[model samples]
Target chain A: MDRFMSLDRRALLAGLAATGVAAGAAALAPRALARTEPGTVLARAIPSSGELVPAVGLGTWITFNVGEDAEARDACVEVVQAFFEGGGRMIDSSPMYGSSQAVIGHALGRLGAAAPFSADKVWISSGSRGPAQIEESRRLWGVSRFDLLQVHNLLSWEEHLETLFAMKAEGRLRYVGITTSEGRRHAEFERIMRAQPLDFVQVTYNPVDREVEERILPLARERGMGVIVNRPFQQGALLRRIGRRPLPPWAAEIGCQSWAQLSLKFILGHETVTCAIPATTSVAHVRENLAAARGALPDAVMRRRIADLFGTL
Target chain B: MSEWWTYALSDFLLFSPRTYYRLFALHNAALWPAHLLALALGLAGVWMLVRPASWHGRALAAGLAAHWLWVAWTFLLVRYATINWGAGYIAAGFVAEAVLLLVLGALGNRIPPATGPGWTGQGGTDMGWPRALGIGLVLFALLLQPLAGPLAGRALAEAELFGMAPDPTVTATLGVLVAAKRIRWEMLAIPLLWCAISGATLWAMEAPDAVLMPAVGVLSLSAALARSFGGRRGTAAG
Candidate 1:
């Protein structure tokens, strides 16, 4: 019994020693590990005007769904703080994501002047409620002038677009756009891109999900509308698939350290994608994701390699 | 000096290679002492629970319950801060808490049913070293299998099995099985059967990708049911 107790004590001591070593290493590697500033990467000239923004942005789809509580509220504050601190600009939120818009509002209030870029959506299913819905979205985001006002999921597009057009004409919104994901409304996305004079269009375009590559991407490029890529991680499915696979050596050449960076870099590598917004709740994940915006992107060959890697799964 | 407590703490800390290496460098030299203290306390608590004294049993049960509550609270804080306020997150929390409660209940049952005693006239022998070792080994196997075997390749298997799929019927059937308690052991059978049937159907139908979601659904449900019912009953019965 005494021998067993001594062994247990030794084991505990060893475990603690190990934990201390890890924390010290993390503290030392900040410069090597810190995410790159957004401006370092190639910024697309927003074709409407010459406004340049980073090709990679952050999304708050799942991350910003912080319910009414102090800890959740604090987490949202940290997410926003990490995002802006890492030189992130665009933040996309929508009414469909429950309290996402409200959480952004709370974060923005805490962020004050540091809030970089804001783009939100209006999701009204019926054509008749366009005016009231836009007003509500304006009230929700607490911004009289929005950077981009998109018709969420192509809902009530005909009615909402009219108001959005008027808002853009009056300089209430800098851009007018529409978004659809999950390949559910590809036809609608294509039709909107081809026919309408949209300033932007949001769609899902991950390596695992390349359905948009065929039509919508080409149409967006042709129409000169900035494209936003959503579901870049396929909502955590991609990360789970990769598991503990170590990052390939080639990943460092393009500034990709984490799988999150590799995945986001793939989305940003596409020329047509103006910005890709991958969301996360943790500040650590947010910081890791923001690293994708720095350094060189994968060329055509690397993109194919990425696709091949995913294809194996 | 308890081997299992030492193993659990060491294993938990070792799981993260990056974290493990970082902690190795900290030379602060206090971590070892703290871990030793924690392990000693844990072993003492476990010993007290197995003692033939009524007061010790009650005290150990209270300690276990308090420990469970603390862990649950911490998990709740993380989940509530991370996930959206919806039925899914709530349901996930409920499932986690239920599993923890069931496991603790099993452990509680292992403590011999109380009778008039002062470490004498006990109805049965204590779980003793052998049974404790067996329980520890069973747990270690359960924890390690998901990382080592076919389960480790679940993600790829799931994707291949459910190619561009949305079979609501399969999803609904699995959901029903998950909620069913009477056929707890049968829940294990359903998944193995589903995987076999799905594999056969895929081969016979010449639709390799068609059975993906159903196969995945079955596999996941089967694994959960197996864990909930498998060695648990044996431990409780013992």
Candidate 2:
């Protein structure tokens, strides 16, 4: 990622410098300055309660399930610290992610800050296991309360949702939600949004994976539901696809400096998208991720232009 | 999606290739000394296969049993399961395979020498290239499998040597079985199944040297079936 950043800086400077005009360098100066400053990330209000969280969060999937190895654990500690220090508030994890929940606990234990908003999941097929699994997740996170608890991928949604609601009512969870991003599950996810009362909905939405753009986003808006976007980089495939390609010039117009920020900013541009949690083990990528939050978001018109440009790429 | 398509194998994959193999590399690093001892024992078993005797059979079984136990603890239970939950079951299978090998070793002279179309058996001999290839494959599993990791660009400390990593450990065991003349069909069961399972997993992960595992499975199973059902001494005991 340092390698990518060096090449990105060179391209930005060269593109501006090649113009042989002070105006070109002056134009990019503010956005470049904004990139270094903290608390610049865009924040959105959760429709259900008007609580604002940075539109950028950290996800713990495979990147954080590093078991008990001290070296791997230390690497994760660095990433968590980087994300938190970058003004990141939401740190999402789950028990189903093997040791990710535990690794989060390990990282947080090392940090000892007012840790990021704990967003966890209860992912089990049977209703009977929800309590134990959720409890285990809580223990793994070292938190008595989760800011948000989601039914992962909507596995046995009703049973888990009922448990989440009961927990929320009891003050164990500040909010309850359901998650689905697989295109095949969207139909059912849509039905759940209309039928159930939710504070947040975790969904997969990105430049290439715009399947949720049509119905899911609208339903979430119509229902006053907050959206937490996952897989913003399509599990790192997006960055790999955009490898070494210069950032689209217009990305600078939106305070974006890297493809990571561009991909994240594109998602945050949507009014319904309260946040997009892009997971990364590299602290450099974490800095790149939080930097996406600071800049001006593309409006609906610019979003389309961004989408069209992304399509061409 | 259909109601049944809730979760597929692809959904479970959360880590990247670097993270996945790095786990193996770390597993190898933490258990540095074990690799030397497991490899020496595995090579000894390979050597004993050439000089067939009841004692060699017993020693080979005990050696493989030891390797299986170590792999289950260090590779599967201790390391691999951290990323992939399916590894717990794989660990159990390794333990079961170890027990089966111990049972085979305890059977004494009943364990037969290497036999097939090209090798000596109870009532017949039909030495062929299959026997030669089987020996070569087994030797490859023990001696050459360790190099797969380094060759794929990982460091030497991260190399997945036999007796330390499950893939090479199981593959080498299957190879040794293929090179053997007479062993219970039950003895071949778990390792072959594991080869298929591990192969499918590595393929899904897009791991380096993934194809070799299932290749060993297919080649060994074909040889076992040919020597057993396609022989004059098919029903005869050692």
Judge the docking of candidate 1 as incorrect, acceptable, medium or high.
incorrect
Off by over 4 Å in 2: A1-39, B1-9, B108-111, B115-127, B182-184, B231-237
User: Which digits, one per residue and each the tens of the lDDT, describe model 1 over residues A147-264?
Assistant: 9889987887888898889888987788989987766677767877888899899998888899998988878778777888898987777888889999889888787788878888
Q: Runs in model 1 with CA error above 4 Å?
A: A1-41, B1-238
Q: What lDDT would each prediction earn against the true structure?
A: 0.55, 0.75
Which 10-residue window of candidate 2 chain B scores lowest in summed lDDT? Answer: B118-127
For model 1, what is the alpha-carbon lDDT of residue A138?
63
Candidate with best TM-score: 2
Which structure among the candidates has the greatest DockQ?
2
